[model samples]
Target: MRFVRYGAVGQEQPAVLDADGELRDLSGVVPDLAGGVLADLPRINPQSLPRVPGNPRIGPPVGRVGKLVCIGLNYSDHAAELGVDPPDDPVVFLKATSAIGGPNDPVIMPRGAQKVDWEVELGIVIGQRAKYVTEAQAPRQVAGYTIVNDVSERALQLERSGQWTKGKSCDSFAPMGPWLVTPDEVGDVHALDLSVDVNDARMQSGNTDRMVFTVPAIVSYLSELMTLHPGDVIATGTPPGVGMGHRPPRFLKEGDEMVLKISGLGEQRVTVRAEG
Candidate 1:
């Protein structure tokens, strides 16, 4: 099933996509797709729920996210573009939950920012607690998958002295979801294609099949280091062709528009704006 959260920010209502691809209100059944509730989303008849009227703002599918963990350089080609060798293990980082925003929300370029960039990634939403889980057990712990636009500030991320968090956790940096698609609906997660387009031209294009660390490997590895709770998200990492990897090193500017998509999960259309 493809689950979604729609309405205004902080006032979103739970919903599920029907066979006809219409949004059906699930608020009557579940409060929100967050915390422990994700572990046991009821399998009910979609037709029974009231149909949502017209179009509404679509918020990130998972709410009250405890942790927005991100894996850096999960793609070998991505690592190469950054002039770094692919790591033997996952390069973990964190994006503040405050960075979470709706799919179509505008990306606010932080004040004094000079290197805003885009990264299209696949995100995993944890459905249950996981600790020391093996690769085989990883699948069961995932609630679903979503698209994540891991926006970044390269100057703060690489040119500064601190960790990547400072550059990665800016407000409106992590735009997620149009849907949180259940595992059964995704068929093969590793084969999905991902892309990012700036304006109307394609800037990034890659596939999950090229990931240095697979979903199961990433989930299992992270579980060994920390407990994975429901509603916690893990952005597996982006593919090559980010603005930073361009010949002249392109970066986001105010009024720029970005369109990101991952196979099956859905798409995101966001505009860039300068912080007031």
Candidate 2:
């Protein structure tokens, strides 16, 4: 089932996408799609519901997010485009959980920053607690998957950064959701198509098939290093075609727009604005 949290930023209500792709208000029964609701998704009656009028705001399904993790250069082609060797293991980083925001909100740029870039990523949400789990047992630990922008300020990330978080953890940087698709519903997460578009111009286009590290491997590796708790989100990293991958190094400026999507997980379109 495609589960969603709709309404405004602080007031999003639980919602589920019906079989026909219409949004069904789940607010009547489930208050929100976090914690216990995520573990019991199978029992949801998506059909016996009312259609949501207009386009309700799509917030990240899991409210009150815990730790927000990210894997860098997980795509071989993305590594190639950047002219860097793909790391032997997943390159891990942490984005501020506070950076999380609604799926369609504007990406507010940081103060004194100009080199904003977009990365389309397949995000994994943990359902149960896991630590030191094997790859074979990893998929079973994941609750579901979602799309993430993994927005970055390239200059801050590479040139003047102590850590990538300086550019990665800005407010509104991580625009996620539209839906959190359960693992069973997504089939093989490895073969899906995904892309990112800036102001109607496509910037990143690729597939999960190109990922250097598969979902199970990423989860297993992460679990070994830290405990995976419920409501934790792991952004599986981006594909080739980031603005930084360009020869002239194209970067984002104010008033830009980004429409990013992944197959099966749905779409995320965001406007870009400078910080106040």
Candidate 3:
């Protein structure tokens, strides 16, 4: 089942996509797709839910995102592209929850920012609380997965940053979800393909198979460093082809558009806009 949330920004209602691809309202059944509600996903029958009257605006599938953890350079090619050695352990960082935005929303370029860039990452949504979880147990703690565009500002991140979070936590930076696909529905998480296109030109294309640290490994590694709670989102790093790694480098400007997709996780379309 593909879980979703639809409506205006703050008033999104829980919903699910039936096998026929029709939207079914889950608002009457679940309060929102977050925390314990994610754990109850298997118990709900999407087919039995009332059908949404027509196509509605889709919002970020999960709400009340507790923590947004990210892994840097998890892909071997991405590391190579940046002229950095792949880390033996995951390079972790935090993204402000305020950066969360609907998948197709406009991406705001910060004032005086010249290096705003894009990263297409696989987002892992935690279903249950976990601490010190073994790699074997990590998969069981996952609720599902979604696409994450890890939009960044290179000048803020690499040039003047105390921490990468400064470049990563801008409002509208993390555009997430078209649907939250359940773990069972996305068999073989590490074998999926992901790519990004800017203004119809393919900018990044790579497979999760190239990841230096696999999904389960990332989850387990993060568990040891911090307790992973329900509703916490972990962006498991991007494959090669980010703007920063391009020849002569390319950065986002007003009116630039980005389209990102991951197998089984749906797609996202984001248009760049100047911050007001």
Q: Provide backbone clash counts, one per model.
A: 0, 0, 0
Tens digits of lDDT, candidate 3, 205-236: 99999999988899999999999999999999
Question: Which runs of model 3 end up more than 4 angstroms from their true locations?
Answer: none
Task: Report clash pairs, candidate 1.
Answer: none
Native-structure RMSD, model 2: 1.3
Task: Specify the highest-lDDT model's number.
Answer: 1
Q: Write the per-residue lDDT of candidate 1 for residues 43-148, one digit (tens) a residue.
A: 9889999999999999999999999999999998999988999999899999999999999999999999999999999999999899999999999999999999
* TM-score, every prediction: 0.98, 0.96, 0.98
lDDT of 2 by residue, 157-272 (tens): 99994999988988998998878999989998999999887878888899999999999999999999999988899999899999989888889899888888899999988888
Worst 10 residues of 1 by lDDT: 36-45
Best by TM-score: 1
Off-target runs (Cα >4 Å) in candidate 1 are: none
Window of ten residues with lowest summed lDDT in model 3: 38-47
